[model samples]
Target: MEAKKRTKIIDVLGSTSVGTQVLVKGWVRTFRNNQFIALNDGSTINNIQGVVDFTTTDEKILKRITTGACISITGEVVESKGKGQSVEIKVDQLEILGDADADKYPLQPKRHSLEFLREIAHLRVRTNTFSAIYRMRHAMIFAVHKFFTEKGFFNIHTPIITGSDAEGAGEMFKVTNLDLENLPKTVEGHIDFKEDFFGKETNLTVSGQLEVETACMALSEVYTFGPTFRAENSNTSRHLAEFWMIEPEMAFYDINDNMDLAEEFLKYLTNYALDNCKDDLEFLNNRAVEEDKQKPQQERAEMTLLERLKFVVENDFVRLTYTEAIDILKNSKPNKKKKFQYLINEWGADLQSEHERYLVEKHFKKPVILCDYPKDIKAFYMRLNEDGKTVAAMDVLFPGIGEIIGGAQREERYDVLKGKIEKMGIPEEDLWWYMDLRKFGSAPHSGFGLGFERLMLFVTGMGNIRDVIPFPRTPDNAEF
Candidate 1:
């Protein structure tokens, strides 16, 4: 009688009955002298150790097998002697599916710099660090959907291309089809946008908050999880030209409620990743954080994935008004050199990244929710507070990652919004549809935009934004 083929190594390990025959297919991560093969089935971060005795295996065929070679194996579960984990597989039969050239393949056993790995973005996912990061990213995405879906929020798809600029920062990647040779031009040789794709002009969306507000007015609670593009020329670890943003808009909500929701959502996501992607997170903690000693102790805590997550989930996030934060910064230790970073003492100046990082990582020592930013520094749609000079906007700052969430209570009063738009010199005609929301039956609504990549960065302990995303799009680098 023929021996029955079994399930994957992952499933076999979970079963009570050891020594069960199994058929597993995976790429060879490492191979040793026709005696053993370390294979990964992509089922989990843990690779199943396969022991193949050379006496039974063909030496000629074993010579052809190399790292990264695809193969299928019929094996029996056995105890592992290796340091990786408890389980291993004793191979009964091995079949090489495809050969991988040891010299030509870019990935080697030695560590490669992230910069070099980025150049070969197509193959980086196969690496342990990137593989773990991408898996955690997938888990994080699902967790986001689950969190919003359970809360009765509607998932709305906002347009990628829009006629009106979302952020009004004038940093947009233009979309046009006017050929240079046959372009429509005015008498002075300036290109005319009248003949362009949208008849006027259009560009990729910077945020979906505006459109999400429109949907929230109808659905009462709506969110947009989509790709947002910005043409800003910032070359930093925190900035990306094209990235994902999660904009959740709620009707009849205040800034406080918005902050609460942002805090809850983040806690949920971190918990979800901790619960669902334990192995991957462990791999990241051991492999990624171990190399960087500068990583904070709170970030490096070895609490079982869930424990680390529960720390944030169960605890109340620290809250500080922008005014209070400014006061704290002013009263910080009497170091003259450190004071230079806080030079913009007065209100209205945009909070710099360094200030944000210091506030969360140093002052708060936990996730900090900073609210009531200066109206002049905030977006036009934010609701003005009773103070008259500040707006009801908030940013949630995490320890390693700064400003994971930026949100505000929107201006619901038509007159106030119109006046603000006019004062900002924005053409009212362009925002007619947005104004309509207030004109009809606008109630006080609030929302926030969470940078998805930054969240991934926090979860994976990845320092650079480019390292988290599969294919990073930057000013000069857009390679696949």
Candidate 2:
């Protein structure tokens, strides 16, 4: 007899050509009644049910069919009489690829806490929750490239190791080959980088904005989607030692243009998730609803996951100047500012997360774009506004979370950029190439960065930012 070809669980479930022999290979999620098996291969959130005839099957073979064991089964596809599934497998052959002791396995059939799952990050994807989260994670990544590609933007691979501090945040992870025990020293007793790799101090890039902007000067529209690192010691749920950023830079675009792209890009991705990851989102939606029941009423999200996604697509984002937002925070009807628990009177004060939450959830009741922030609070690359105190920057805020996306129009003038670099105490020589762009053919350019995990957090309705990414790198947690 000719061998049957392997079929994915998703494809097999949707296949109308039933009663044909097909090979199903995956890890066993559950074995019940000594005759049924729940199998999944990370193809989707759902599993394909395998029905075994225990009367005819060997006792030794059945004993080895435990949870977390890898197995291969050749079965005939048939219409499922069971609920919640379309098709199932009638097992004619069974072989255990690997055996996992039920007691020794980290994952069993029962519900596992997210905290416990983090310890076994390698195996978390086997669960329905993480499988759905990752499927959507993949869909979002594909949608990002599709959206930009359809808009004539070229995807540029930026360097992971860089010699410049693009954000001037000074929270970068340094990269060096110098021995700490016997380091090369300068005449002034400072560490000498000239003798080390790159012949100068370098670090894992905090952002690819600088390099992508250079591509934008020539390509007109370019984007960088890659891993970035930060050496900050913040152990909050919102901070990560390493994360992915989607930064798109465009030439001849101002702050207004930047806002337009940011809004469109976000909506595109959200709508894409709704269309592509319907089953996955439905699972996550239920997951979030159940997770919220354990939280206090005041801490619960007002909207469900699906509702939150639609909220952004169905509503228009409110745009206002930073000063205008502060004014509303102080004088809005119902006295939202009075209950803010902090002063919003200062003109140059950085808007905290609470302030942003008020604007999105309480006051505006929709997404909000706070624009033209005070220059002192923004990066040095942002275009200085006409008032001389503010920069042409904007942040896109969502209902559940405050700031989801941030961008700004670049400072095109060489002298202004040079002065800002010098004023910030950044060595002008470190960014000589960046200065050259401004000196030669600098044009009005703008870009925004969407933290990939942040978007995933909102999309998946995951509270901890660590849960969204596969292998999270936090302050004190780097295992697996």
Candidate 3:
């Protein structure tokens, strides 16, 4: 006879199809009471219990049903009498597809610290915390695409390697195929970039905003979602050497318009995760609550994960100028008492993470959008304000995550942009094409770059950026 068709554990556990013989395959989470097994196939966090008759079942088969062991169960689905689950499998037959030596398996059916899980990154996804995080990551990604698609924005693919520095931050990872053992030097003994593959210096792109703007000029609205790299050596929990970024550029948009789109996009994503990934969110929310219990009272989050997400979606973000923010921080208790590592003493000083957290978490007590930053502190492409001292830049700061979105109304005047480029000492020749967009057909355009992992950190209540991303790439660490 042909073998019974296989069914996923999610389907079997979620449905009320009784008296049906279904084959379910998954790893054994635990073997309880010697006759009941909790099986999970990563379809959901909740595991289905498989009931076995210890009187007839072979002792050897039961002994192999340990944690992390893969097994196939041909059983009848029936209403469960368990406390937490509604249904379970009444096993007619059980076969061990793969045995996980209980003594050797790294993952046991117990709580593991996030740091320990990072060491065993490959196997961490099977854990309840990671599984829930990754599932929510997928939901957030889908929500990003859906929000832009519904808004009629064209999703544009930008090149990964380029010869230009869009942000002008000079923190780019060099991309070259030249043999480092051998030397290609000029008359002055400087390494010659002309001998490189691109004929000039090239590096992994830091942002796709510049290229996306060219597309937006014609398409009206365009966005690029791709991996971006930075060569910064900071090993903080928030920094990543390689991360995904979402940049949306729109023509005919000023600073205010950019802020509006960003706010709406974030709110939509929060609502989407609440609706689509309810189970995963609940698990993560509870996990966060448990994790917070170990910390001191002051260090814990004021609101739960679910409540925080809801708060962002339901409330309007506070908007203020960078000057106002600086004033607030200068007068705040931290600055007054010298509690801040970098004191906010002046108006043009760039706000550090601690200052930003204060503005969002304490001062405003909501999401804060601070615009019109000092021109010297912002990028060269940002539109300069009428005062000629500040640029129309905006940063959306969240309670726990500082500066989740950074963008500005772009400088569209050809002469003004060229002047800024020259003033900043950026190679005018390398950015001739970028300048061309402003030369031929210039329009008021604004855009912002959202760090995808940073958003994931907020949505999942994950303290470290590495936990949200599947495989994190950081300074001196690239292990799978």
lDDT of each: 0.82, 0.91, 0.91
- Model 2 scores a C-alpha lDDT of 0.91
Residue-by-residue lDDT tens digits, candidate 2, 367-408:
999999999989999999998999999999997778999999
RMSD after Cα superposition, model 2? 1.5
- Kindly give the stretch of ten consecutive residues in candidate 2 with the minimal lDDT sum: 332-341
Give the best candidate by lDDT.
3
List clashing residue pairs in candidate 3: none
Select the stronger candidate by lDDT from 1 and 2.
2
In the order shown, what is each candidate's alpha-carbon RMSD?
2.8, 1.5, 1.5
TM-score of each: 0.93, 0.97, 0.97
Name the weakest run of 10 consecutive residues (lDDT summed) in model 1. 299-308
Per-residue lDDT of model 1, residues 1-480, tens digit only: 224654665675566255667788888888876777878766676677888888877988788667888888876778778786688878888888888898898887678989999999998887888888888888888888999999999999999988888778999998888897898988889788998988888889999888888889989999999999989898888889999999999998998999989998998888788778877888877665456455676555443333435556777889989998887766666223565454655555677776776776567666789999889888899998888899999998866556788999999999989999999999999999999999998899999998999888878877789999999999888887
- Per-residue error at 441 for model 1, in Å? 1.2
Show the lowest summed lDDT stretch of 10 residues, model 3.
1-10
TM match of model 1 to true structure? 0.93
Give a tens-digit lDDT track for model 3, residues 1-480.
212888887788777488877898999999988999999998888898999999999999999999999999988888899889888889989999999999999999898888899899999999989988888888888999999999999999999999888888899999898889996999999989899988888999999999889899999999999999999999899999999999999999999999999999999998999999888999999989999999999889888999889878878999999999988999999999999999988888988889998988888888989999999999999999999999999999987788899999999999899899889899899988899999888999999999999999999999999899888899889997
